[model samples]
Target chain A: MTYLNKIKIFVLVFMFILFTSSINAQWNIPADAKNKKPPIDPTHTLVKTGKDLYKSNCASCHGTPGQGNNIAAIGATDLGTADYQHSHSSGQTFFQVEQGNGGMPSFREKFSSDEKWCLIFYIKSFDKDFEISGEELKEQKADLRLSLVEKIRTVKAYATTKDKSGKEIPLEGAEVQFFIKRMFGNMQIGELVPTDNKGMASIKIPENIPGDEEGKLNLLVKFKDTDTYGKVIKSKTIKWGSKLKIVNITDKREMWGSLHRVPLWVLFSYFGMTIGVWLVIGYVVFQIIRLKKL
Target chain B: MSEVNKEGTKKTIGTIVSDLTRPIKNHKGFTIWILFLLTVMGVGMMAYVDQLANGLGVTAMRDYISWGLYISSFIFFIATALVGMLISAVLGLIGIKWITPIARIAEMIALGFAMWAGLIIIFDMGRPDRALNLFIHGRLQSPILWDVTVVTTYIAISVLLYLLPLIPDMPFLKKAMTDQAKWKQKIYKILSFGFEGRPEQYKSIKKLIRILAILIIPVALAIHTVTSWLFAMTPRIGWDSTIFGPYYVTGAFVAGGAAVMIAMFVLSRNYNLKDYITDFHFDKMGKLLVLLMLVYFYFNINEYIVPGYKMKAGDDHHILGLFTGHYAKMFWTVQLGGMIIPIILLLFRRMRKPLPSLFIGIAVIIGAFFKRYIITIPTLVHPHLPIQNVPEEFHSYWPNAWEWAITMMAIAGAVLIITILAKLFPIMPIWEVAHEEGITNEEMNKYVKES
Candidate 1:
């Protein structure tokens, strides 16, 4: 009894240490990085984009920020807590998110600088005490017109804001993002750019990307910061991409396919053996009836 | 073989038929046993009712341990059912006389378990209403389709093998069972098919039994082999081995042999047929059980040690789980207690006696049940992709009350079948037993009246 109790205590204590000591690997950022502020004041637009990005990148380890369901084995810290928010500055959080350590991978290439900042601020939004400084813009009624210059493979977007008088005027300095639609999610194309004084921005599509058999690709262009410019989107099909020839493995007759597509050998043998066995069984059963007749 | 009668007493045909058929008219014990079985079956039926009404939510099976106690019980029935073929086709074809008394018991077990083996799989389905989809959408390449094919064929052959032998014995059963229910007596008379001392019919019965036995060997082998294919066809670690067919087949014999031992002990004690199912038979069955266990154990070592020795990435977690991990207790107990310990105990002359062998049989049987459990549930629990993003309940499996009740119902249903067969007909084949004592066919033809 005492032996069992001692072992039980040891296990309980061991588990306690194990769980509590699930501290994340310490990150060391330069002192200057800790004190640096966000170039633009943090806004709800950035935070929302950051939350969406965080799901694809970090949720596997850190879990939903406030939900404490973070992977303990990986020693991921709950970033939504006040303690985490108060401890790390915007630059330090941005640097940590960009240059990760241990089990956490560097998202240096995966996100743009603004996206990294967006993520830091989004994580901060979960902590109520952390004050966000951005004055969110009032709703702007905007229309973004898109045109494709097929010869140059360049897509042009002209951003315009409508006045109360219903007159269109060029909307300057609008942040825009360009993307080509993929199966599960969108694939970002080119860098995030702002509209010029003429309220027009242009991006050249890559020449080698594969599209459907008709050499058509779906393109989507939207305002990067919805709070600043209001959420407006434009999408169109362009014929610039190379032809994609689809050859699915299931198209051919194979083992993993449905009945009609299964290999003929498998069908023949399976039924042949089945029929053969049933035939003999039928014969033996027939013999029983013949005996009855006699 | 002639030395089976330890008492060396010669019995006339009259006492033999009466002693064997006496239990048919009298089922005071039978009624209670059937009631007990029916109560279990009733509970299982209610559980099935609940499952049908509420959906598969009644079962504890999740995406992982989807094949739970129902499949385990189904496999266990197929395992026990294989013994009838082993005893009848293998040992009897070799001209073993001791099996004369035990052969019918083995066939009763075969017929009973085989019939219910067909039904037990239905309990596994939540949408049994959509079962036709299996036939409609079932692919030729799938092992599940082949499993369905072989099982029905096996049941058919087993019925023929079981009934063909009884054709010769039916005349005696018809006459002796006149005191039985009119329906039962009519069944016997119909079963006999007017074989009144016909020499040609006797010859035909022999040829037909041989033909059926020959047929059953492959179908019997295929019955379990195809069952093994159900597991082996999957690329899962524990079930992925090429040797699984022989491994499962050998394991089936061990379980079936032990079940037969249990049956032999029960019938001899309860029915007072010591002269028929003698200690000598138990002794022989003990030896057979040891041989079966050892062969199965050899396959066990091959199945486990080869993969265990390498501890290949996927195989390691699975092998370790069975060897010394979460499933270690079940694995070691099944291996050591079921096969090894029984093998060691049954080797002793005294342990091979009816009573001692019964306990060993019970142990092996319990071990066998868990052995199938170990084979089935553990493989799913230790799937290649780590169990993640699922509830904690999905981490392990324990059959809920409904599952256990339904599983008990399947087992009791099979036993109930054997019980009914035992009660309705002579436990021993009258014609065969009389012939074993060197009686000619002409004499056996009128022995019903002469006795």
Candidate 2:
């Protein structure tokens, strides 16, 4: 009885302390941290690393352009809007990113200070005033293809971005998504992948998927939205995999067999009653014919 | 009433024979009646041909309401066909002697409807040509196989029951009618089988009749029980009940009994056989109808109350539809006029008399036909999944003009068959009547009188 009373009193005191502390604690950053300037340049290589990290770690909650989708619903600010981008100094935004508020988690341990500054520069690019040249847009074309590996009996799709002059440029930061077109709709194959420095991205087509009756499959590779390059999709059909088989009849040993489904007594009784009644009817007809002789 | 002799005793065998054969001998309006029936049947056949040419798409039936008027009419005919079993076998076995005069009328009605019952189903099918598949590839487990088997057996037994008593009457008709065609005489002579009133022959005939009578009861029960199984075997809301067999049997008796009464009224009025089909027969039929309706009422309560009480998920919609929804009016009318009012009216002596009984009989017949309609159509519309993605018309059913024409023609066809049979044979069993009156063959010829 004493132990129960002690627990009840302890819980009440702890709840009271927690309630008062939360009410007083404001998510205000220090003035020195808010005024701090980034030491590194917003170079292309840094932005590329930031884009890959954003897709993997942050795009799910912040959305592709950080427009605040369902994830991190409470405090995921729309990073694209000019009001947020222009109002906050990069230092203030960096402090907020490092120290998350409410439903947002702190990314202090996950990313380096240099990587956080790269993310800030990339987020500011979503604003319309952050002008991108037409030459840069023309160079964002991705070359996507599918190839079958005969030794492994597996199919792989590769995506590589090319420059405007048809030069093979490394599309290091683009996200490649794979899909297979089915009769009803397209089915996603695997998780999205980021290309390496060599501008190469590939995924293994699963072995178990049943293709068309002729054992042909249509594989689709997509270069989804990226900071530098936009979106690109390509499809290829290959003769691979086993065809689907449909079996209508089963052996008598199986549960679905006719022998098991229909009971024998039902058969015997149905036939027995039918024949017995017909025999009686036949006798009556014989009686009519016999009446002809009377 | 039959004419009285000089001594005020009942007329002898000769007068009985002449009076009984008078309807067949008469020519008044017979052609017109046949022509009317044929015309209706012709119009129906033309519509059937149109249905055949255009496909079942012409009818109002669709994916949801697959069955319509033809199936209901088929059920009505099967139910009406039970009169032969009720009057001839059920009552006859119980020694109801008054039924002897009316038994043949019931048998004719049974034969007419039973024959068409088999044909009426063909009208509902999209491919009537595939009918042979039923016999060739019929599955034994299906209730349809049970129905076809029992309907054929019932038709055969009903024919034998109708023909056996006609045997003794044929020879009497042969001797009495000199004006009938020689071919008709030859046919009668063959049909009579030279039955010279031998004691051994009478004994054999009696034994055969008793054997058939005993045999018919089970077949009769099987026919309607199996018919009811067609609905009860399904998992539909209102039809899926254990009592459907008895419920259908009792309802059949009500419809069939009323049918016999109607035929009794019409034949007695038109053929002038007032003495033969007397007030006593109508009174007996009326009392039997009352008993039947009361038994059916008990089944009706059991059939409805238990389901209505629980108000199970699917059944609630169906019960509400019949009780107070769109179908409430027709449903209540059929219940009140068909079963309830008839039961109430027949309880009084005056209502059981010939004229009033005739009106009651008509009401019961109409109500019985609609009763089958109620049983079939509502359950179909109330299928488990909500009705969707079909035409607006598919949600409810009404028999269109084409459907009505075909259904009415089927009824007319049954009447046409009965008319032809009545024209050929003595409507009542002459030999049975004479035998019951204790008249002999020698007395029949000697006391013969010209009508």
Candidate 3:
């Protein structure tokens, strides 16, 4: 019994360590990103731009004044407190904003480098002591190659960032996001996948989700913004699933749902009353016509 | 032929016909009344144009309380229309002989109100242009479709019922009025259908009237029942009750009885029709009004008390609203002054007189209109879900000037229909009255087989 108890204790401690480390893994940043400073100063113009952008996009999830919302309760980082702003460098903040974390989306395609630097400065304004210095950011050209070749159910993407000389270089340590387009918004399908050494990421499509009316899917694979690579999005349309059964409305019973069809008794009474009334009316009309000759 | 009564007073067929047809002739007040109705209709038309230009926004209706004065007017007209069925069909089928005096007037009211019932629904529609969609995509399961169907059927039968008995009066008018217009002569000629008071013609007309009387009873009941279903089928709290059908039917009879009394009093006073529409007729109508009001009071108890006892979650709010909340004053006024007071007053001998009955009818009509308003607006105000985000004005409904004007026009329009119809034909059935007086045409009764 003592031996079994000790084994159980070991397993529990091991799991505790594992979970704690993985949580720390979510905030992983390279030494270069940590040391790098923001290229732009916190000018009034840049701060104003950052404030507007944050209100339009980030405030919905992160909350106004960076106080955080219910979305932040789940895993979103709160920028209101010094605990988060003081712990992270401006470059690291810019990288986090570009690439995004769990529920947040990559704003790399939506924001330029100056815009991101401005956002970082405005976010830093929440904490009094937050300050940073950095070198100028070099413009990088990047693109994503998306392909669906696994019998139409698997999505594969390769991302590459080019140097000033236009030479292709594998963009590693970057997160790739995959989403399916829906009527109102995009639905994330799988967990965020990090690019391998070859700058490739792949995710298998789940089987149960219904596609569009024509059984077509628009798969969006995005190479989120990295410090070295720019943001790139590539989408592919595939008709590689079973077609949705077209509802034959002509044959289907006219009802809101399957629950409330016209009951047989109601129809019986309605038609019965209708037929009986009309029969009487017909007799009356017949009587009137008979009066025509008189 | 003239006959001398026991008291030595002379009664002649010529005087009886002339007395009944006096209202059909041009009178000093008749033109003024027509002008008044036309002015009201004209102003209502102008307001309708404004409503069409600005949308239903011209009315005080909003998202929370969508229906307003127009729907209340629709319910009132439908209820009033049911009176024709009550006097003409229900009483006629039961072989009540005294009702023959006002039977034609009852049919006229029915035809006018039933026709206007359809128009009131159109007036309530935000997109009146899409009304054809009601037929194109109409579902049999919808209570509205049932209402539309039954109301149309009722109108058709009411029209026939109004026309069939007019056959015997046609030759009398065609022969008596030598100064009739060329067009009037043509209408009389066409409508009279060359009747020479044949025996077969009387038999056929009587048979047809009997069949229509039987047919209209069920159709009338169906019209009001299905109209009640339009509210009952909904998941509304106060409206979702088994008694709504009978409650609406009884309420209809009360309003109908009152409307007929008002008409009877007006015609009797205007044309000196005291000999035809007598004190006994008003007394009988007063008794009917009391009976109908009592039955309506019974159903009102069932409709409200059962729901008030348990005070179910949603219904509690609605019942409280009517019983003691914002709607309490209007609700109690209609119940007491419109129903209870009238019922109690009508129970007395002097109150059943013609002049007293007229005041009672006017009071009942005003009460019925407000009663329909209470039934419609309160339940909507206190929906299952608490009203939110809507404008504060939407928290309660009050019909604006345009709504009132338009609704008043619909009433005036019904009166106009009754007016034009009364002017065109004799308001009283001459042959039926003569038949009741035991002055049968020998030629018409020649082929009648004894039962």
Top-TM-score candidate index: 2
Find the 10 residues in a row with the least total lDDT in model 2 chain B: B1-10
Model 2: per-residue Cα lDDT at residue A8: 100
* Model 2: per-residue Cα lDDT over B74-160, one tens digit each: 989999999898888877888878887899999999999999999998999889999999877776667887899899989999998
lDDT of 3 at B317: 88
lDDT of each residue in B1-451, candidate 3, tens digit only? 2221222234445665776666666566888999999999999999998888888988999998997888888999999999998998888889887788799998899999889889989888878999999988776677887888898888888988998898777777776655767787678667766565787888778888888988888899999998888898888878888888999999999999999999999877777777777787888889989999999989988988899999998888889988999889999999999999999999998999999999999999999999999989888887777788877898888899999999989999999999988888888887777676556677223322211
Clashing pairs in 1: none
Candidate 3 C-alpha error for residue B421, in Å: 1.7
Worst 10 residues of 1 chain B by lDDT: B1-10
**Candidate 3 - CAPRI tier?**
incorrect
Candidate 2 Cα outliers beyond 4 Å, as residue runs: A1-28, A35-56, A63-94, A107-266, A292-294, B1-12, B57-63, B136-139, B193-197, B312-314, B381-383, B386-392, B439-451
* Displacement of the residue B202 alpha carbon in candidate 1, Å: 1.1
Q: In CAPRI terms, where does candidate 1 land? A: acceptable
The number of the candidate with the highest lDDT is 1
Supply DockQ values for each candidate: 0.43, 0.19, 0.19
Error of 2 at B397 (Å): 3.7
Against the hidden reference, what TM-scores do the models get?
0.69, 0.72, 0.67
Q: Which of candidates 1 and 2 reaches a greater DockQ?
A: 1
lDDT of 1 by residue, B1-451 (tens): 2565767577667777888887676666777888899999999999989998998878999998898988988888899899988999999888887888898899989988888888888878888888888899998888888888888888888877778888887878877877667888788888777766578888888898888778788888988998998999899989999998998899999989999999999998888888888888999999999999999989998999899999999898898888889988888998899999999998899999999999999999999999999999988988878889999899899899999988888889899889988887788888888877767788776676654
Q: Tens-digit lDDT track for model 1 on A35-93?
A: 87888767866777788798888898899887888976656788877788878777888
Worst 10 residues of 1 chain A by lDDT: A16-25
Query: What TM-score does prediction 3 earn?
Result: 0.67
Ranking according to DockQ, highest score first: 1, 2, 3
